[model samples]
Target: MMTQMMDILGPIMVITAIGFLLGRSSIGFETRTLSTVVILVATPALIFNTLTSLDITPETIGTMSSAALLCIAISGALGLLVLVMARSSVRSFLPPIMLPNSGNMGLPLVLLAFGPEGLQLGVAYFFVVSVVQHSVGLSIYAGGLQLATIARQPLLYSVAAVLLVTWTDMPVPNIVMVTTEMLSGMMIPAMLLLLGTSLATLKVTDLRPALLIAVSRLGLGILSAVFVIAFLDLDGLTAGVVFLLATMPTAIVNYVYAERFQHNPRQVAGSVVTSTLVTFVCLPLLVWTALGISERGSGADAQLSQAMTRTETSLGATYTND
Candidate 1:
């Protein structure tokens, strides 16, 4: 189990460390430009390539997406309850607790732990979270519903293109596939680097509020995912993917939104940094736990299949004797 955990997290830690070092150094790279490239180009290409290449059905995607929504809703409700009880600012703390770093931290972990099929499901969940973070999460900060935020996401277009191709049974040209694949290859590493650099830049102003939010985010987030998995009867690879994505730390975007709206950005930044640090400490256990759930679920499925076969054979034998 320790070896497996290292295998899953080693590459992520190494690349992110490099990014953190670079951020600490006087390297004058334009983070905004890199972020724009990721959002506008690489991310969309990655989503398109992964979804189209895989044999994932729309129903499977829908199920994962629904799970994502439910997890977010449950996490948000839990966070709200805690904040209300503590007399905290719901607008500032709620978004960080509810939304997660599904894009930056989640994709690489899922890809490493569960491989291509898990990536497909992770992408579906990420897509849903991204949409909600931009719309509903933004509204929470902006103090108004910003449904228009969804229309601006390139992820929306890529997913639409995927659905169009899937429904129409259109064959993608080899060149397009190759191009997207090449672009998609950079997505994970770039996002990891971005995560590390972003973390390096964030300052934890007040440790108390930050720690409170961080603990709430990870605790409520994981519990919420567990409830959703059982509630939705999710098992195997799907359950693992959902669990990992849901348990990620507060997203950097939450800080961005808070800074933009002047809604306690420092506190949000502190939460992002604190939660990420805490998540790293908890990652090994989390990975082990997720893998265990998947394995047990798979075992349960195999047993059920074997039992059903045995029952069928017994019925056939009795009918023949009759």
Candidate 2:
């Protein structure tokens, strides 16, 4: 188990470290361009391919979707309290605490830990985060609800297309599917490398608030995941994925939002760097713990077991069966 956990985390740390080193060495990689490519090209293809290819039913989608929304809502609720206590603006603080790095870090971690089915489920969670971040997160940062921003995200369109194809039993042309599959392959590594580069550029002027918020985000996330999993009856891989995601650090993009809105960019950058470094130390233990808990089997565990059994029985294919 320890070895497996290490295998999952080892490459991530190494790749991110490389990016960090490159940045420190004054090697100029156009991170803004890379970020745009990831968001506009690689990530959307990955999302579309994952969603379209997965053999998930509406129940599975609902379960994952519920988990995602619950995750965000609970985090946001706790963040509201934190904001009140800190007496800070939503623009400066709420986003980092409320939104986990579901795309760059959370997705890759789950993909490694849980495999393709797990990645599919992770995408479901990412979908909700993307929608919420583009819409609600933007609104908070922009000081008003920018409904139009949601329409501008390529992921949103990819999601819609994937859903339409999934629901209608429509056949995607082979060429398109192949193209997306090729692009999807690039998503994880690119995101991780991009993460390192982004970390390289982050400047932390104040460690006190950054550390406080970093701890608060991770601490509140665990509490929220526990409540949400039990309340929503998620178990097995789904529960494990939720728990792991709950432990993820703040998104690097929050700094972008902070910088765009002039809302304490240094503080946001500090939180990003602090939480990401903290994630490096915490992820292996957290993943191992989640796997152990899921294996022990409870309410959600039983459901997940039964669901996997049904899937395997019906399809004659193996599943995670843990």
Candidate 3:
């Protein structure tokens, strides 16, 4: 189990460390340009390629999407309570608490831990989170619903195209498939590198308030995921994917939004940095727990199948004897 955990985490840490080193060095890169490319090009391609290529059922996709939504709702509710009690700025802190780093941190973790199928599910969860974050999350910061912003997201189009193809059983052009596959390859590594770079750049001001919010984010996240998983009776890869993605740290994007809107960006940045640091410490335990849930669920399924087969065989023999 330890070896498996290391196998999953080792590559992520190494790549992130390289990015952190680069961030500390004099090397220059356009963070916005790279972020735009990932969001508009590579990520959409990754989602389209993964969903279309996988033989996953629509029911499974819906379940994952629903789980994602539920996690957000629960987290938001719990976060609102905490914010109100603490008398914090809802606009500044609530977004960070409700939303998570499902893209930068989540995709790679799920892929490494659960493989391609896990990546597929992770994409689904990321898709839902992205939609909500851009829509409702943006509204909280901007003080209004940003319909234009939501409509402009490439992820929405990518998911729409996926559904169209899936429903019609249409064959995507070979060239398009090849192109998306190529673009999809770069998405995860780019995200991880960006995560490390962003972490390096962000400053944690006011450790007391920052740590309070950070702990709230992680705690509400885990509680929300647990409640949703149990309420929805999710298990196996689906449950693990939901749990990992749901429990991710406060998104770096939240700080960006806060800075853009002048909504206490410093405190938001502090939360982002501190929450990510805390999550790194807890990741091994999270991975272990997720893996255990998956294994136990799979084992239960296998046992049930065996029991049904035995029952059928016993009934057949009894009828023969009669």
Stretches of model 2 off by over 4 angstroms after superposition = 300-322
Q: Please provide, for model 2 over 1-322, each residue's C-alpha lDDT reduced to its tens digit, 9 standing for 90 to 100.
A: 7789778888888888777777777667777888889888998898888888878766677788888888888889988898888887666889899888888888888888888988988887888787787788877888987767667899888988877887788988989989999998988888888888878888789987787678777767776777787788766788888878877889888888888988898999999998887676656666766675567566554554443334224322211231
Output the better candidate (1/3) by lDDT: 1
User: What does the lDDT come to for candidate 3?
Assistant: 0.84
Best by lDDT, which number? 1
lDDT by residue for model 1 over 1-322, one digit each (tens)?
Answer: 7788889999999989988887888877567888889888998998899989989788887899899999999999999999999889999999999999999999999999999889999998998898788888889999998767768888889989888887787999999999999998888999999888988898999998898898888878777876787788888889878888998999988998999999999999999999998888777767766776666674354543443344335434543673
Better of 1 and 3 by TM-score: 3
Off by over 4 Å in 1: 147-149, 298-322
Candidate 3, residue 98: the lDDT equals 90
Better of 2 and 3 by lDDT: 3
Q: How far is candidate 2 from the true structure (C-alpha RMSD, Å)?
A: 7.9
Compared with the true structure, all predictions reach lDDT values of 0.85, 0.79, 0.84
Instruction: Report the CA-based lDDT of candidate 1 relative to the real structure.
Output: 0.85
